[model samples]
Target: MAAKRPVDRPRPTLLIILAAALTLLTLQFRGLQPLDAFQQGVRDIVEPVRSLSDRLTDPVQTAWNGVFGFEALRLENERLEVELARMRGNALTSEADTELLNRLLSEVDIAYSDFDAVVVRILGQPPGNFSSHMIEVDKGTDDGIEEGMAVVTGAGLVGRLEQVDRSRSLVQLATHPDFRVGVRLVTSQDEGLAKGTGTEGILRIESGVRLDAQVDNDEVLVTSGGRSLFPGDIPVGKVLDPDSDADYRRSIIIGLAADLENLSFLKVVLPAEKPEGMR
Candidate 1:
């Protein structure tokens, strides 16, 4: 017997597949209702598998998204923080500008409103043993600021311009030991000399009111303007106490009206021609 020969099995031709696809397409285009039912049946069989696959992968996709989204959330938070800080800075600047404008307006409304004056910002405090006794202002002789000119704030007297340069002037604070101003009691109509005690925000009255004169606590003191240093009626301070002896001469302590520690803006009274009929 001869060895058995292998026979080749027949495979479907490409033409047969093309014919089958064309048949399905033609049936579908012709609105064949049976083809639609057959397609729906196939989809129903595949739908359960797809739904199960999505359920199996859902937690893993969620965890992956959370891991990546955390960084995105962190970056967003940092951006917001920077924006908030910028807004806060702008708010502070606006508040400061408003305060400065109000202060300048108030200072302009004082007794020197009609007088020629210059508004100067305090540049620094001079350095030395008298550092506490004086502050530096941004105005100088070039701006018509001169020594002996009085410095004042909206509240009251701050000091007198002492050393003046071309662009800056030093203010001798009224609290300096040698500082003196003629003051009059508002209530008693008595005049007195107020002297600084080398202490901050304090003054001592001397050589004006006699011991027999009536002086009371909390009495307001204003400049007498006798010596041409300060304008008359500028507030000096309030009387704290009276000190009198057998000589019938009295001295009193004064609490300053201006808050020296927080001085920022001031007015320098310029020398002007004395008005007719005015001292």
Candidate 2:
């Protein structure tokens, strides 16, 4: 009664070993049917516990999602806003361009005497050190734009077509060093050669007057009829400074009337026919 028997302990251990061996043999032969049934029973018991665990952790998972997802959402919103602003700017520019083209085409078709005109878009810009006066247009001999053709904008005279290719033309602005046009000063009633200085807004006038000649600033200058390229009586520039020494050959500086830097559209005026007079 006081001592436990060794046979009892051995019997329990043998029974446990026999049970484990039988379970393994059954799994190997019959594909674990009994074990699957036992696992299903265990799942039924643990389902409530798993549900409780998920409920306890729901707020933490939600907060983690908000922290990570908010960054991507904010970046997407910023990109959309920037795209909207860019499209709006493009729309406004398109409207302004349409209005300008309508006005220029109508005015040129009616006012010009015997010359046909072709509108051209500026493709490339000249170097900045070249006074930003000259530009390249997208039209050339293919569009009937040839060398020595006059280029003008809605505001005033822009330049002259210098070199022409099959599809492109180089425009030498009124400020080019090689540019010379006959101009008449309105205020002084003085006629002189308006020549370019290769600098922005600068033109030089070589007056052929005598030592008694005198002129003031802010004089309105217009193109003379003697020029072969540009039209006659077109507004060109305004006088800025007169020569200090009037006794010598006086060279007056003039400022161009047009903004050559921001030329988007221009028209090339074809050569006009000579009128039948005194021939």
Candidate 3:
């Protein structure tokens, strides 16, 4: 037996409701006050929920997108951190250079001391435990610096020029054990051979002046020009309180005038020109 298919049924209720809705929309457009008021009320009630949904969904959508871009954000932050560090380092270096320039030749009276000088900067110390009493400089024969030239700072004498190159020179500091300078007492006029004790920043009169010489505490010592390596009247150091020996001699320690440990700028003394005939 062949089975017949069930007939599809259409109800008039849905059709009637749709026709009513259409009639209401047409009347609303044609100055239907009640329907307009009803639509207004419906919009007012739904608007808050719609706005709340938009607010909530926006952040969630943004967070979902951000999860995929987290590595890019982290990399960007690291790059910013490096840039900030480099800027900070440059600021500190600028401040340090400003302070170093304050210690320039203008701070001292080199012209009053009879030195024909050229300004230079200290490069570094020689690399050895034994060579701690030397400093390398940025000028040499090319800059008219010669061996045995006096090296000085604004405060006072630093050392003498040692090894000379075309563009660089080594300064043998006054603190070296073999260093020697003829110095005279500013008050008593006593002259002596001043030698480094290998002690840090200290020198002593090894000989030349008698043990009974009138040396006083805090007395100023200056260079003696006759046959001396350095010119006369350059301030060398101040005598500390002399240590009295029972019989041998007074142990005198001189505090160096220049701060050798933190040198920055320096001057090399050129030889004085002979007076018209000795040249």
Candidate 4:
């Protein structure tokens, strides 16, 4: 009787209780189906850690996208910039060619057969006070550009060839202080010596010409060949204003018919001996 059945251990009941406690802990930790304060506390603590983890991984995702997207965007930007530059360059070149063509056509129409010449491009602007009104051209003595030869463009007379080298020439613009033209007003047919005064595109017409002369603004002035430095009948400039009493000669200010400030092309005329009959 004393050795009857081994005493049944309470282990099964303890295990059952332990398992229930563990299940309750797991539910609480997982915030599952429990609205208790303990569960809410667990959830609050874990929520911030999870949010931090997602934030930390965001940079990596961004970097991965950049590896593929960055090159495409960078290349596209470069291509667009290059294209824009090319288009601008093309437009500028087209404008320049158009100007040169017009100049050549005018030369032909004027029957300037005495000069064996082609259009030359202006390379750079001059550097001194005189340079502001003058330009350096791509022509030289080797190209038959002689000093004192007249330089003209499509719009009008630009200047006279000043300095000449074997490969280049300097043009003295009509606005230069030394520049003088024996010009006649188109409207009044009044003759005067037009001399540059070295101001903003202004010329002094000798006062001997009538002060009250009815020369309108933009009246065409042309070379009259009085002094013989320039050929006769070449377009010179347009009258900007009539002379005032304070101004010398009540001078008719002149605006150069050619855009001297922005010239790109020019034509040089070789000195031609005036025909006896024409003279």
Alpha-carbon lDDT, every model:
0.75, 0.70, 0.72, 0.69
**lDDT (tens digit, per residue) of candidate 1 on 182-228:** 88776677887888898888999878787887777766677777675
For candidate 3, write residues 81-156 as lDDT tens digits. 9978997879988677445433322243223256788898876664467577888777766677777877887667
Model 3 stretches with alpha carbons more than 4 Å out: 1-112, 127-130, 244-246, 274-279
Q: Residue 171, candidate 2: how far off, in angstroms?
A: 0.1
Give one clash count per candidate, in the order shown: 0, 0, 0, 3
List TM-score per model, in order. 0.56, 0.52, 0.56, 0.52
Off by more than 4 A, model 4: 1-117, 126-130, 244-248, 274-279
Q: Model 4, 16-134: lDDT tens per residue?
A: 99999999888867866543555445644664564586569769867986897798779878998998999887997868755654463354343333454448888666445647667
Q: What is the lDDT of residue 155 in candidate 2?
A: 55
Model 3 / residue 23 / CA error / Å: 99
Which candidate leads the pack in lDDT? 1
Candidate 1 lDDT (Cα, 0 to 1): 0.75
Badly placed stretches (over 4 Å) of model 1 are 1-115, 244-248, 272-279
Q: Give the Å error, residue 136, model 4.
A: 1.0
lDDT assessment of candidate 3? 0.72
Q: Which is the winner by lDDT between candidate 1 and candidate 4?
A: 1
Candidate 3 positional error at 228, Å: 0.9
